[model samples]
Target: MSESLGDPASAEMNATAPETFRARFETSRGTFVVESNRAWSPNGVDRFYNLVRGGFFNDVRFFRVIAGFMAQFGINGDPVIQGSWRDANIPDDPVLMGNTRGRVSFATAGPNTRSTQLFINFGDNSRLDEMGFSPIGEVIEGMEVVDALYSGYGEGAPNGNGPSQGRIQAEGNAYLEADFPSLDYIERATLVGEN
Candidate 1:
């Protein structure tokens, strides 16, 4: 991993991404490929491309996988690196595509909160379109691997038996390793052609 991704606010993330590209993810469960279309969500695609190329998703846990819904992840395992991105939010993109099964979108708390977190829809979640969640890509290979990610811990804090995002941010993987040992994680993720 390079230092470039450690600083999410860097200008490098602002460059527009390719018209279309593929990211291959090798995970604890297996492998999957996501094909991102810049036209779908330019800013989101650019941020994702930079992150994938700079190796930010390595060792990141699939922290929030919900059955029949989506698999969410993308918090950096190192708290220091994660902290650097805390305020690096991006503007929301228009929903150009439906959030159907296999669609990938950034997770947001509200308007324009997309930073590092992303989710892959497991079912038709088109209802989220009105909520401003734009689909930047779709899983083009090994969707089964995504579906196989552990979801035993349901939703995070104040919801179900999952680890708290607050604790994950503060304590890094230590909190997750101690509490959510069975969580699946990305071994490494990289831009397909570059690697």
Candidate 2:
């Protein structure tokens, strides 16, 4: 664990601290809440918990959003933090829950590759279960806000007209705002019970 994003030592110490927690995201679209259960995906939940506590998702854009597919985000606004978390992979969790609509899970390129990126399913995506995507949480409120997020750019670069993950990681929000201005972004993310 590195301290680039925040106090990694403290995050590690709190890794096993909670079995369940709720995160509230205040985004440009609207507000939504995700209720995460560690029992479903311990490592994923822990990582998300720490990231929220560390303010990693603040001002992070929803860079990849497809109408009926999913909406993705979680790259840090700061390029350095994004770079640091690029390879900070967490071990895979068993698929205890399917990737149904509104369910949130860590996005991965492959096994054990989940770092800071995550997506909320827009429709039933049970196929992703076999591919090893485990849902750590689900939207307990404001699913409409998630659904209404801007998807005008469609899929990201190399796939569609949207921003590229590589560029996002390298340039952060500056590149997104310059090129993809309509993209929605999180204004802040905070734990439900925390100040």
> Model 1, residue 29: displacement in angstroms?
0.6
List lDDT for all candidates, in order. Answer: 0.92, 0.88
Off by over 4 Å in 1: none
lDDT of 1 at 132: 95
Tens-place lDDT per residue, model 2, 29-131, is 8999999999999988888888887788889999889999899998887788777678778899999999999999999999899989999999999999999
Off by over 4 Å in 2: 1-14
Error of 1 at 162 (Å): 0.3
Question: lDDT, candidate 1, residue 184?
Answer: 99
TM-score of each: 0.97, 0.94
Candidate 1 on 1-195: residue-level lDDT in tens?
Answer: 876777676777556788999999999999999999999999899989988988889999999999999999989999999999877899999999999999999999999899999999999999999999999999999999999999999999978889889888888889889999999999999999776
Model 1 TM: 0.97
